[model samples]
Target chain A: MKFKAFLTDNGVSLLEKRFLPALDKMGRICHLYLTKDHAFFLHNLLNGDGVQSIAQFRKESLFEDYRISSQNDDRIAFTIDLGLLHRALRSSVSVCGHVTTATNRLQVKLVKKLTHNSQQPMPFLTFESKGYKSAVIQDVPISKPLSRVDVVELQSAIDMAQDLPQTLVQGPDLHQLQSFVDRLKHVGDLLHITITQYGDLHLQLLNTLTTLGVEFRKLPVVGVQAHVPSGDQNMTAQSRTKYAVEKGEALSVQVSLKHFAKSLQCHLTKPDCAFYGITPLASCLTVIFQFFIPGTRQTDKSISLHCRLPVLDPGSA
Target chain B: MSSSEADPDIPDLVCQLDNVQGMVDALSSVRWKRHQDSVLELSEHGIVVIVEESGCLQAKVYLKKELFVSYEYRAEGRPRFGVSLGVFVDCLNTFSVSGRSSSIEICYPGPDMQLLLKSVDTPDACIYAEIRTKVPDTISWDYNFEPAGSTPLSFTVKSAALKEAIDDLEWPGSSIQIVLQPDPPCVQFRGEGHGDLQIDFMYYANTDLLIAFQCDRLVSYRYKYKFLRATTSNMPGSVIKDNRGSKLTIGRGGMLKVQHLVSVARPSTQHPHIDSAAYQQPSRIAYIEFFVKPEVDEEPVNDA
Candidate 1:
């Protein structure tokens, strides 16, 4: 029974780029769920600001070489301190490393470059010795993996979160979005975001003292058009045009500015992105953010990050 | 002020600040967290800006006539305008964002005039903002401020020390109990939350921390910690601000006024040797007065 995983530069880069932010959104506490096929990370955000996020990557897509015996049936999972993981990655000189799972500990092998030269400063020696690279392995202890019931619940939640209907605000380019966020930065944490039937997305901020709102009217959107909520109508049909508020009334959700700002951060990474469908659940408002960055070669980076913003009032519906 | 340009409207007046940017920056530093709008009063004696917080607090930042290079106003009586502080600050900081320090000229045409701000550096575009001229509710700038009976207790402490005392308080605290005494262990701060936090600072008549300490009677007053925080958070932080520190003056009527000292940076021009490394840029003394009214129901615990 042989099991070894070679982490490539691409895998490390993916973690550096995407998974790290996901960790931040999830309040630096998340589970690294790994299988033979791919790696899945998930976390339920804390604070009244309900945000849940999951990042998944196919093993073959990110890793250059990964070998696992068919005899192992159970998927390896561990609760990782995201901040500590980031620190370890940063401290590792090579950044790229391999991970081989053991019974109780997860082994991480980071290739660190050690420079050996004359301890003297020589002006003539423009070219020094090519640094010697050595692999330094650090084994991190694994925490308790999720039980069967927890895994089932996590899967169903992810499934229910998939294909959510949302109305994306249109017209304003990335620059406008950045300015809008910057302008509203001083306002309190609770951001009241509203979408009307006429395709106006209004970001409002209010506290016990003052109220301020900015409206983005006739925003561009995907193919889905705003539809009215029919009396005694199909729930599925209503969800299709998720952005639609009641007639002459706006459907508004108060979300944590910090979490919402994290999703908007996606716009910074990729200019062409959409704030997708929103599903207001009992506990959180599930918002899907889809990013499509043009790839250099064959496969482009297209990923959907789901952020569950906690509903201030569960009885509002 | 340059006596250069011409515009319409009678009783028109204009002025340029020595460091116009200084005036702009001073006006912008006003953190009136309570209200979205503040009243800006313009007279021949410069501009007086006032903002109220949570109804209980009123703040005034006075940019006097002396600060300007040429102050002139021909308008009948002192014309006042209510302006959104955030928007006004945004307009003032536009040139700063463009990486150019600007020379500003403020123009007032008449009572019903829109405030016009022209930048010499960015001559291509100037900001013209509508002055909310006739809002009566926004004109609560003047407060009697006279002590009712007793000589109001006064003390001066380093902004850094006061900041530390405030920070030492545990969260969820509602009231800040300030104990001022004339005897030993002169001043003490008490904050009540889940538990009580007490910080005692010995008072000296003249020191870096305590510039002035005058408490004729031992008086203790409790103020809303939140209101105090709203003002202290925007204080001229001890680091960047000049030597003059913050002063706390508690009135007999329980008006807790904290004057945070601010040194407005002025561009160097008086010195001939621009190349001199030690030629320090001039700084004008300014202060933001945060007057927080105490809870009417709470009685002062007098140790007199």
Candidate 2:
């Protein structure tokens, strides 16, 4: 297996300052999955507990002169410490001043290191930056690459997690939501999230003594439209109209408040907006963080981040 | 819909407050401990929250009906309940957005007799909370606080300065002696322990600092330094920011009463509709009083 890439200036900044730091808040260690066209940072995919987060970036958006060769369809997946990776990137940028410039070059390569005391060599992701006066090189250790069967299972988990809920509603402002959730954290251990077809999102915390709730109304819907059968369009439309006259029935799921607050830390990335999705009877709630062009509403497809927060059992709360 | 509208089960009390921070400030002043329980009493005229500590210190926060934008009380008699002071204050803190003001509607006896609070002004979002309240037991002590004589010994000082003076005396002693002299028309705070520290507030020295003064004779009483510190330590920021004055009165039986006024009015611009007709009217205020019993053994000095 061989993998080498030169990071662009923008890529270094985005990874060092935004993406990696955000992932670091989610978990201590994460799997770095590299393929021909994309790279993914995944947390808690194999673990049955805790929140799972996936951050994806298009290869071209972050790397130049990228090359990879492996027996498993040119794909490489290995676990690494998020903090170490972030520190390495930060040191490289600070040391080289203007990385990727004519005189300063930054390259990331996967190599094996031989230690005097050990017979077997250990794999390391090395950051090598050269400047006019000084050169900085940092080595971050990595777990052994996953076997083919393990890679297939990991890919399946990713696909399953990517499944979208039937209904998705935009979330409230990050600052407001953060403050609200923080208050809820003090009141209860579990949070109940309710979403409706009419663009309302309700968050509630309950205890023996008090029940606290917050509702965001008329939020824009971004997912699938309410299902209406084509054959019985007229009758269904009439019935739907009647149902609309009544209050919209809401779908709710209970999740740990601690896990929910941890996922909200993605606000540090300063995403344009966040969307929430909950599938009925599902064991997790989906949160997708969308980044947009600086001044426009158009989404920046180059990067994406989403999290799956495990829902507590209905009887648990 | 207004609570006045006829319904099968009308709530015992419903009130709307425009400035949540003002209410938060009033309640937080008496929240000296993390798990203190406060008794909430509702009357047609206003609401009173009473907190006491081991029968030595008692605080009362009076939020009159005028302080609310709307008040509806239909209960036949006064209803009282007990709630955790810290939880209630922390919950109210969430309703207050820093830059903008939001009105909150408070309702009592929520189906389960819980206190219900809902944010009313925001069109896009609403925050609702229900805090469980217990049936209150009879209060520990009720000091009638009758005046010592025809002219009560009382003085008003700038809250900021008073807070500073009390805080500065922390290191000097465990007990503070307060003396009011009619001859010089000044109040003296004396702390004695490892060292002695005396702070004098002369009535005529600085009108801005010492706003009011009244004394009949030389009356001095010593109080626990910790109890006196509680009164000034948590004086809300708005009181200091608005340059309000706090009145310290020595009632009969060596009882100390500290009175503070907190404005409960949101900016007129935020409630133009309500303030349009009577914009010149002064904003309503909430009254907070802390009653502390003086040290038992030290007889107060009285010059007849």
Supply DockQ values for each candidate. 0.03, 0.44
TM-score, predicted candidate 2 vs. hidden true structure: 0.87
Q: Which regions of candidate 2 are displaced past 4 Å?
A: A70-73, A97-99, A112-123, A141-153, A222-249, A293-296, A315-317, B1-8, B183-185, B192-197, B202-208, B268-282, B298-304
TM-score of each: 0.50, 0.87
For B92-127, candidate 1 gives per-residue lDDT tens digits of 543232223456666664334455554444322222
Which one wins on TM-score? 2
> What fraction of the genuine interface contacts, i.e. the true contacts, does candidate 2 reproduce?
0.65
Candidate 2: tens digits of C-alpha lDDT, residues B1-304: 1233354268879999988988999998888877888888888998999988878898999999988989999976687888888878877877988778878999987766778898888856878888999977676535578787899889999999999999989989699989999888899999999899999998888888889999978888888999999898888988898768999998887899999988677767766886653333444788899999988764445444
Candidate 1 is scored at a TM of 0.50
Residue range A175-206, candidate 1, lDDT tens digits: 55555556456546777666544455555555
lDDT of each: 0.55, 0.83
Residue B99 in model 2: lDDT: 72
Residue A289 in candidate 1, Cα distance off native in Å: 4.0
